[model samples]
Target chain A: MREVPVGEITKVVRDLFIDANINLGEDVLVAFHKALEAEESPTGREILDELLENAKIAKEEGMAICQDTGLAVVFIELGQDVHLVGGDLTEAINEGVRQGYQEGYLRKSACHPFTRKNTGDNTPAIVHLEIVPGDKIKVIAAPKGGGSENMSRVTMLTPAVGMEGAKDFVLQRVRESGANPCPPIIVGVGIGGTFEQAALIAKKALLRPIGSTNPDPELAAMEEDLLRRINNLGIGPMGYGGRITALAVHVNMIPCHIASLPVAVNIQCHAQRHKEKII
Target chain B: MAEAKRIKTPLTDDVVGELHIGDRLLITGVIYTGRDAAHKRLIELIDEGEELPFDIKGQIIYYVGPTPAKPGKPIGSAGPTTSGRMDTYSPKLIERGLKGMIGKGMRSQQVKDAMRKYKAIYLGATGGAAALLAKSIKKAEVIAYEDLGPEAIRRLEVEDFPVTVINDIYGGDLYEEGAAKYRRQ
Candidate 1:
């Protein structure tokens, strides 16, 4: 069995958090540039230009791309042949989140939901783990902000509503969201799963690079269609209005009960911060 | 279309009235910062007949909770948070003569109505452009609710802070009007 030290996971997670916050991925940056070209509104084009500049400034100065450093969401794919030694895996991840947010000068956004008490450090990060076939561990760090997370929605539609219903639901969500989730957003659609699974996959879809299509031909077509319909809503950049409300729409699907068609729309703002490390 | 306007803080009804939906603004001067927790307390103080920590008359409130500053920096990335969350408290604050709000997103109908009635305005700053926005903020100091951390009330001095007038005193709304103008179908 391949042995991996748990402390190393902590260090990696910490660095990933800091890195993801300060750097805008090239894919997201390219999407912004493309949107800038397609956007019809002069004000919307200006907003897109400013966003590109903002990304550059954040990277150059080692500052956060956005004030909301976000709730740390870590996805781990642990190889079955690997043995993790030294400490509990989950705590190591949280420790990394603690160090990253504290030392990186990132905001500690985790708080008591009801009482609104600050957790001091952004700890107890949301961790999702899966046992994979290989010997290497893959860690994905995604900092999810409250505004976009707040705009996400899930609804279980009747089987009769079918694929058209699913499309309409996502479109409605984006239209209703308007500028709230920060327009020029990315849409992640999870379809054909159980309720909870659908929501989880919808969020996971956000991690995919913009412009990447689904593996399945049919799903890929649906993604393209949804992307078109969403932009047609004219929510535009920061909702100033234009032809580029959504940068991309990604859909992931798994088998579900024949009687149900559960779907979730996880909205992500244009910042779309995520990074992955394999070890 | 009118040219983008340059304005200063302690915004007055006359200046706010001259603005319209879709007008770009370069706002300079002092603006107060608050978010969800701070807004709750501000309204609570108003309801309890306690004096607000900051003046409301002719002042602008920026709905933001900034990241912690690094050493040698006045503040960290500071961008506007979603404004809808403040809908319940904003009208109450507007009733007290709060002249303007800088945030991102669409406001509730009640807020639009209040803005019209009170002659206040709502400006939309670029969401997620925190780093760029921070450059405009020359100084930031926590004025109240220090325990709230990032949600603490801060008085910030800004120069050429960019924003678009989303809701103006004359019942104009950029979100609605702009969407209708550009929406296909």
Candidate 2:
């Protein structure tokens, strides 16, 4: 059994949060560069250029790529063979968020929902933990800003609505979203599972690298189709009417009840800030 | 369908009226920051027939909640937040002489109507470009609602703040026009 000290976990979480906030991951940067090349509309191309430039400035200046800095969401894959020493795991994660936001100068966006009061420090991270068989502890941090998150939707449709309905729903959401989510955006579609699970899966799908494809051939095809349709909307970059409204469309699916075809569309802006570390 | 035009800030009726959908703007001068909580409070003050926290006449409000500034910086990454949430309070603010807004997404018809009536304009900043956007803000000082933390109203001095005219005073909407132009036939 591998015993990881609680202090080490706290340090890892703090460093990961700070790194994720200030840095735009290389995969997302590469995707933006590719989008700039593929964008046919002059305005779309210009928007892509600005996005790339923004990433560069953020990296060079050690500033957050986006002001929202988003809610601190941590996904932990804990090994059953590992034991945590010292403090509670959840508290350690929250403390990391507090330290990172404070030290990194990242915005503290978490607030009391009804009162709309700031949480002062961005504490109480949204942590999702799962126990796996490995001896290593893996943590993934993704800061989801409000614009794209506001556009996220989950619906349980009758099985009769089928794949076409799902596609249409996603396309409609993206179309209506326009420049809000900061195109060229990423569309994460979660199909099947229960309603909540579908939403979770869609959010999780966004953590994957921008251009990676689903292993399943059918799902991959659907992703392609959705990507085409979304770009067809010509929302362009920043909705200035261009050909490249979306950089990618990713889908993650799981089995659901026969009567249900639950779907969730999770939108992510061009910033696409996420990072991972292992302890 | 008109060519894009670049404009500076501290906007006037003439500048706001000349703007059309899809026009690019590089704004300078003073702009303020406010969001949902601040908007609600500001409108409440207006409704009560009291003076606002700041002068709203002929001013632009950015829908943003910025990160804490690093030492020696005026502000941190301060990109615009989603605008639709501010739709409710915007028309009223426009009625009171608000000239422009910098944020993302579409607004309600009432807000559009108010824009036309009041000669106001709504500009869409590149959402999520906070760090990049922050470089343009030369100064930021909280003017009101300090209790709101990030949502506090801030008086900002800016230079070359980039934006696109999403809704012009003439009732042109870049969102609808842009989407229609790009929609598959």
Top candidate when judged by DockQ against the true structure: 1
Highest TM-score: give the candidate number: 1
Residues B63-165, candidate 1: write the lDDT tens digits.
9999999999999999999998999999999999999999998789999999999999999999999999999999999999999999999999999999999
The TM-score of predicted model 1 comes to 0.99
Q: Which 10-residue window of candidate 1 chain B scores lowest in summed lDDT?
A: B1-10
Clash count list over all predictions: 0, 0
Candidate 2: the clashing residue pairs are none
> Per-residue lDDT for A1-279 in model 2, tens only?
989987887788888888888888888888888877877767667677777888888889888888888899999999999999898999999988889889888989888898777788887799889999988999998988888889889988888989999998999899888777888898998999997899989999898887887899999999999999888887888888888888888999999998899999999988887888888
Give the DockQ-based CAPRI class for model 2.
Answer: medium
Over 4 Å off, model 2: B1-8
> What residue pairs clash in candidate 1, if any at all?
none
